[model samples]
Target chain A: MSSTWLAEAFAVFGKDWRSEMRARHSVATLVLFALTTLIIASLALGPIGASPGERSEVVAALLWILLLFAAAAGLPRAFVHEEESRTAAALRLAARPSAVFAGKLLWVASLLAALEAIATPLAVALFDLEVASPLGLLAALAGGGLGLAAATTVLAAIVAQGRGATTLFAALAFPLLVPLAVLAVAATRSALLGGEAGPVLLQLLLYDGSIVVAGFLLFPVIWNP
Target chain B: MRATSLSFSGVSRRFGRVAVLRGAAGEVAAGGLLAVRGPNGSGKSTLLRCLAGLLAIERGEIRAREEGRELATADRRRRIGFLAPDLALYEELSVAENVELFARLRGVAPEPGLAIARRFALPAGRPWGALSSGMRQRLRWAWALLHAPRLLLLDEPFQNLDAEGEATARALLDEHLASGGLAVAASPVSLPLPRITGELDLAR
Candidate 1:
């Protein structure tokens, strides 16, 4: 039973990957938006020499803002594309609801990871951001990215059902993401200043866990409706 | 394979205050073809979706049983193949790739979509987006039949088909019925299949 679940989810994941590989539209849009935002914000900020602490806090906040908004823009593609293309019905009939949710969540998480790989380096290099604990910063980014994907993928499924889903996605995503963004930013700031980020990291992990559980439980209700 | 049966009783659905399907009911046993005919907004598609378990029925039970044993919801989904007018394949994928994906999702080895594609003269190497309306309709049939489901539910199954494509679809439906597979189809126009033994007209 578990094997079939895993196999079905993998099938969905592969299908999404192959389709995305052909189009690359969503990835291009996301990466471009993240790069453009980082460049514009860094240039606009000029050189902020106000102590390393203040600089770290501001830069960390800026990074989360960029990543969060980028996620809000792109993650909806996982479910929204299915809804728009009218393929969701075919999928619903073909795979289990939980399998579909798992597959979509995996796809969104992968996209988040890729976006971070590109955006993090650009943000660091362009902003001249200093991180005392690079490893801790990476951990925070991973946790934050997971949390962001978990929270938004379910919401994406919800909004995908409505007309004007794209616009509704933006309006619905921001409020739901506040808790994730706050913990992520705090952890990122702590990581940059070489402070103990373990507490915030733990909090982010818990948040990620809770949201993923919630998403799995709630997705069938949202999906089948 | 045991003879399959899809039975529904007093199935009703609503969108807000507007009831799309009220007290709609029917049954299609194996080797039987049931045509669901109605005008627009009569909930033909809604009935098909409810039977396929894609939509929740507000007040009804849709059961797919075999040899007197009821199939679970998940099992019923596996045994059923669904096609709708608006149902689409991956536009980025080739004809063969799209069919292969659906086959794999059904936990089956990819069969020859080539024969089906050739029957409709579908360009096997072309992306779905590049296919014409008739070709897309043909491919939808190919995808639907790849798994050889026990219960086939189709909505507006004859749309965008030329005479040849329509003939191909008819032949496919006939073959499914011959193999003791039950089929329920929704169409605005009459689909005169010799094998059709029952029908649910929503106009009432």
Candidate 2:
């Protein structure tokens, strides 16, 4: 990208970051949802009474699902807030659609990464899980976080334009994100079980790239329309 | 650089089965003002939006030119400043921050916007949501003039303003036209402009 485009994108990102800092709506919602879900899951499961192999699998699956649902609950606010506040038209006139998309994508990715940083260790401690490959775990989380951000950011923009936005976002996001979730679960499980996570990591990487490219390509149409 | 001018003819737009604007036409040369006068729900806002390239017209042509060269839609949009009741800045941001944000997005220095805000006597540190309605209208003017756009598309330019605020707005519009800038204002009452190049009266 050209320096001007990057500068404009960063301007948008900074604006969103500052706005979110003051409002704290999405952050509060995401944190509360994630924490509540984690608490409920831990209480209900109460230490997985299964084989070590099955325990890791269950923990991995549960962790990804929790993160995915939390993302669904909060990320749509990125664009929905703009529409609700009547700022979308001013933003549309001020910046290019691609720049706006990139900025929102960055904000969503940053939020997801931060959520993972906090929740991953918390989940590990709560579940009493051991990581066999820290590098593999990190890779899976990083790739998965970026892919999830890419998919949700564009979908949020699409959802903001229509009615029943919250319900629409969940309906649109879960089906699209299932593959990424599966890859993330498998990679996490492999990392936890000392298995080779190379193939799953590669697949996750491909998924990240494909979804990001698709998001960039599709966002302009969705944003302008 | 030659002065910019705008012309539109046979413009028509619809929302579902209802036609909002039908066969609306007008033109304004540089250093002139075109007043769009009409009653409520007369599609004055729709026509201004169409001229700003914000909404697509069903069947019509709108063109902006500078130096005898027709400007493309993107080029026109870049040089056009638009303001309406529905358009809003970030409420959480302070006045200075909002001005700076739009300046950076428009790729211009923030100094000009800051200066404009100061000229309007706006509190730089005040949050947008905390501002009164009149103050908000002044801030909108400051934003619209931030980039020194060639074409100004203003809808209800005098809304929610006291006499002093209205005078400030009038002075700004007068200054803009005197500097060879073009303007199209949609208002229910007559504008205080000294010279109106043309008027498109939309009937309800």
- Looking at model 1, residue B102 earns an lDDT score of 72
Q: CA lDDT, every prediction?
A: 0.84, 0.86
Tens digit of per-residue lDDT, candidate 2, span A35-131? 7877787677775466666667777888789788888888888899999999887888788888899999999999998888877887777677788
- Tell me each candidate's TM-score: 0.93, 0.96
User: Measured against the native two-chain assembly using Cα atoms, what DockQ does each of the candidate structures obtain, in the order listed?
Assistant: 0.56, 0.54
Q: Candidate 1: which docking quality band? A: medium
Error (Å) of candidate 2 at residue A188 is 1.5
TM-score of chain A of each: 0.93, 0.93
- Clashing residue pairs found in predicted model 2: none
Give the TM-score (0 to 1) of chain B in model 2: 0.95
In model 2, which regions exceed 4 Å deviation? A1-3, B1-3, B67-69
Instruction: Judging by lDDT against the true structure, name the best candidate.
Output: 2
Candidates in order, interface RMSD in Å: 2.7, 3.2
Candidate with top TM-score is: 2
True contacts kept of 2: 0.49
